[model samples]
Target chain A: MIRFDDVHKSFGPKKVLRGMTLEVPKGESMVIIGGSGTGKSVALKCVLGLIRPDSGTITVEGGEGRDRDAFLARFGMLFQGGALFDSLPVWQNVAFRLLRGSLKRPRDEAKAIAVEKLRRVGLKPDVADLFPAELSGGMQKRVGLARAICADPEIIFFDEPTTGLDPIMAGVINELIREIVTEMGATAMTITHDMTSVRAIADRVAMLHDGVIQWTGPVGQMDTSGDPYLDQFIHGRAEGPIEAVR
Target chain B: MTGVLTGILGGIGATVLGLLAMIGRVTIFLGQTLSHMVRPPFYPREFGSALLTIGWLSLPVVGLTAIFTGGALALQIYAGGSRFDAEAVVPQIVAIGMVRELGPVLVGLMIAARVTSSIAAEIATMKVTEQIDALVTLSTHPMKYLTVPRVLAALITVPVLVGVGDVIGILGGYQVATGQLGFNPAAYLKNTIDFLEPLDVISSLVKGAVFGVIAALMGCYSGMNSGRGAQGVGRATKSAVEAAAVMILAANFLLTGVFFSL
Candidate 1:
């Protein structure tokens, strides 16, 4: 479980997150929907301590002290671009967390786990030996997913998981994400503007606007949420309370 | 005229401030790297690969640069010495020049071009693609995982490369002096051996080590601080080589003053 309490972050003159407040309960898939540059990524990064909040508190599982290495061990992130280590083979990339530092296992065991995780993500064993550059976009996304779940982390963050994929591939990834979160019983936090992905992956939906959650409810109730910002966002209307670039 | 002068002063001030900031950042980064070098979680595999890339693989370019520079120095010394009826000084001058200055300096520059540029480009690309963030998320210290191995490898191996370059360079001069310049082979070899002091060899190796640190640090620093996108990578690579070259030459000058003048 993660909690953000009145988080405020600013980059010089540009105020990205004025006061963002949200709480994600354990074992729930919480998807944050927001337009580009709404500080969605920034908020997620704040939780990971990648970007520190100017004023406020973020606690993971009720622990306020940021023991960086130990803290990071509990969570995995799937970056928008997959962010695979290009120098490494796919298997090594998947087993990166297990190959070094505190979680290090023997090389053989790490490779085996990587292969198994690859299989879980619907990748073949043979694909493990190939480099990321050799893989297709969708395949690379799957590999990224495999890596995120390889350590069986307690929590996973998906940042634009289906951004550059085809609709079918996006659906596949969404489904995979949904299945993985359910199977692992892992707390999931995802940020995306894709309505279809929202429907497919989210157990609960939170709409972010102007650096705060404007609306949040169960997935079934997202349609009827009467908040103007949420309504404008979900309906994809150019003319609404949420400004369409003047 | 008054406004333009103020603008000029402002630009100069900004440039100076930027330079100072960069220097501060590099100093902090270097301190972190040195501290991490002695600490735990050492990645010998990364160190080994870096040694191969920065040290062993640099042999060809270093060799070529040293050999050609040595040969050219011999010809120049011979031609210049003839004016003073001292053409016999070719071997002695070439030996001192190559061992004391040319070998280390040229090899260092070659590293700046080949190794520094490559490192900056690679790491900058990694940053751009969010691989660095991924590394952090995976509970790895990016500085320890990336910078320490490279700086250590360069620190250990550049001196060895310099020693090799010195020997090869002297051989190149010997070939030119005896084979082409009509000097007696035995006399050329004897003169080279007798003229060079142990201090000259030590200074060369020391310069090589210092230059190695500058080269690797500049590359890593530029890459780590690089902005986003392809243009950022290109700029980082360019600035890394430029910084490395300038720092090597500057360090060489100070080192030469310390070794010889002091």
Candidate 2:
């Protein structure tokens, strides 16, 4: 449902995305894998218009020409860090979209939805009133996830959904994401380098290197892709086509 | 020696260019903030909170600064005027000075030190944490939600604070004059009231409004453009206060010239 066409983005002398082109089919979880600083985040940001691509077009079901608010209404994002509004309590963060603007609902209704979403993300209802700072890292990520899915968006973007969590918590998050995407039938785009998370959450896998998608196929095909960069990355080998250091 | 001179000239040129570029960016930010302010989806809740933080919470500091400065100004005027046997002129001078200059300027500077720094640091931290991007992804405009409310609150409230400061400052002068300087309380109050023209009060309020806008805008601009991490936040806060203080003083001078010249 989302398409990136010849996206090229540069920051001064550093060219982050050079001709990155990818398509995410509707109702499928597409996980983008890349090493550090390979512009994975930038690519997702381009789709959201958070970072304008220097020369390219990103269209979400031909919604690029729509009103900015309308265009953004179709999607939700969970940042690398939870990115929860620290000033707000957990429930407020989840209900943020519902409490303001075009999607506004009554305060009670919004709070109910927030509680339900929090529950769906494996959080207790009692955690709703607590502030984000009171939550642990894994709990914070769950809260972030709850916020992302609270609006029932048509598409969801997860940026490193399991970065700082323990292995079991990461697995839990990956499973939750997988179940949510399947149950909601939402198009999902997640960017991460975690092989475990990829195996758990992705229907399709795309390996990014040197600002371009070097290999892409079904998650089952990832192991035998034979592309040096993908093989090196998935294997976590220090010696390969992908350099250990910049 | 020749190379060093060329290097110095290059450095000076770069500094001027940087300053001009900064001014240009801030001007653009101000325009965007104004445009957002006039648009729909007004955030009254955020504005109300901002009014409390910027206006109500600021009263104590503004009052303290004004009262102390007024008393100090009275002492200095008494000392200086005594040289020419003009100690009796303290009430008139203090009233004029507090109403026209010190009230607005000192309050503005205090806000720069307190409110401006806090705003910059908070927004910068939000930026670093990616909450700003989250706001965008939620179909909310950061300028409308964050900048406009604070700026509008400052615009509405700082003038009122300046008026309060002017009165408290005059009262402080009266206290010092009547109690310690051995002037009659009624006469001191009368001279102070008579010396302040309506125009002087208006000028003071106008200066307050301008200084408020400067303080709030500088804080928001530095914050929204801050780099990454704790150091970026610290730098943004420092620069915001510096810019606001300098701008308030400079605007004070220009405003004083404008009001008096007319």
Candidates, DockQ:
0.90, 0.94
Q: What is the lDDT of residue A16 in candidate 1?
A: 88
Q: Write the per-residue lDDT of candidate 2 for residues A32-139, one digit (tens) a residue.
A: 999999999999999998999999888788575648887888898999999999989999999999999899999999999999999999999999999999999999
Models 1 onward score TM values of 0.99, 0.99
lDDT of 1 by residue, A122-183 (tens): 99999999999999999999999999999999999999999999999999999999999999
Q: Please list the residue runs of candidate 2 whose C-alpha ends up more than 4 Å from where it truly belongs after superposition.
A: none
Residues B1-262, model 1: lDDT tens digits:
9999999999999999999998898899999999999998899989999999999999998898888888899999999999999999998899899989998999899989988998899899999999998998999888899999999999989999999999999988888888899999998898889999999999999999999999999999999989889999999999999999999999999999999998
- Each model's backbone clash number: 0, 0
In the range B6-121, model 2's lDDT, one tens digit per residue, is: 99999999999999999999999999999999998998999999999999999999999999999999999999999999999999999999999999999999989988998899
Worst 10 residues of 2 chain A by lDDT: A62-71
RMSD of each: 1.0, 1.0
Error of 2 at A45 (Å): 0.1
lDDT of each: 0.93, 0.93
Instruction: Report iRMS (Å) of candidate 1.
Output: 0.7
